[model samples]
Target: MPSTTGSATAPLRVDARPELTGDRRIAVLLSHGFTGSPASMRPWGEHLAELGYGVRAPLLPGHGTTWQDLNRHTWAQWTATIREVFEELSATHDAVVVGGLSMGGAQVLRLAADVGDRVAGVMVVNPAVSTLRRDVRLLPVLKHVVPSFPAIGNDIKKAGMDESGYQRTPLKAVHSMMRAWPQLIADLPQVTAPLVYFRSATDNVVDDSSEPIILGRVSSTDVTRVPLPESYHVATLDNDAPTIFARSAEFVARVTG
Candidate 1:
């Protein structure tokens, strides 16, 4: 598998035709994590697509390729890529719901803040935001000294997937995620849409600080938080993934109803 670095190189495109939008059904844009591909969210996307919603699980910039490609891009480029997909989805559907797994979660939160009124709701699964802990702070420094550390949870799911395996985990890419965390945390207060937060109780990567940050910032009284009992960092593909997908479908249904 190759790493995507947001360069001028052509992307590994997945064509999701707007087959259900003729009846003016809702649209949902599903975003993947930092080092992950659209395969992470395709099951959930297909679930929603089957429920009369148009779905698009776009491959984020610098992903579905090599880790070296990811190292070449920053958070800004990745967010812009998701944003462009959202804009296009919104143009064709009666309503739009934005959601993501991990970093894709941050992009949707920023999108909700930037265009809350335009979005119907948001659903985040094990979203990563703000890595201020001493351990994460030391990662940037360690990268300089250590040649390469295989990123934790960089493996892809073999079930219901249609893409290459996990690509490279670039040190520069991880550092960029750390840098973007603060801005995402700072901008959370501006979001006003209904939200569903799925947290993996045993997630090894993201800390628990995200719960308070999300609860304190969002203005929606209808926020729902569900704890995944058997999942790790990538809850969408973990042991309890079915639960996550069901909750996500319910969240979108509630908001769009």
Candidate 2:
């Protein structure tokens, strides 16, 4: 992974609120990954907002503050936050697209499954649904003994880019995410919204097995997978970011048109 100059010990950046344009008919609710703040998704949201689409990238409950904050939050609270934003957007927008990165991706999938056809489209980048690593399986027990681990934030392949996520990984939160995975997978068949999935060719954090699990299980007939050749897990901030922003905007237009 490419390295940046910012200090991981520095304070997390503030969350980015929805930048609403005059055109409220089209709205997008984007969520960042588990430990990540809205900074990772703000650029993407701003691009869409510039196109006259209303975009909201809410900070997850425990993110963008401290690692201890994340440990205090659960998977249910994370899902609840996104769901509320999605519902609010749905009320005003004629079309709404729910998207996220990594864990955020799984959260949006759950939203699509819960709301079904109401969602105009779904977008995900380097979605983490299932992990092939046996180590994650130990989360249930390990979380009790271990309080934290090395951070998985800032997995970008681009230099000088700061994701502003937590400096450490909270084991309790990781355990909560792992516990929710099975239910998310089980609900995949109910996700009938059109989907555009972006998978990185080389991701150091999320394993390759995750892509197949999501693609194979989702019930959406209208699905497209684009390969991010030069990016890693945080493709939103990597060299291929422009590709994701442009394609996702096009996808929204196509689905909502």
> Could you tally the backbone clashes for each prediction?
8, 0
Winning candidate number (TM-score): 2
Candidate 1 lDDT, 98-128, residue by residue in tens: 8888788888898898886799999998777
Model 2 C-alpha lDDT per residue in residues 168-257, reported as the tens digit of each score: 999999889988999999989999999999999899988988888899999999999999999988999999999999999899878877
Tell me the lDDT of model 2 at 71.
94
**Which runs in model 1 stand beyond 4 Å of their true positions?**
1-23, 138-147, 154-168
| TM-score of each model, paired residue for residue | 0.84, 0.91
- RMSD of each predicted structure: 5.2, 5.2
- Lowest-lDDT window of 10 residues in candidate 1? 1-10
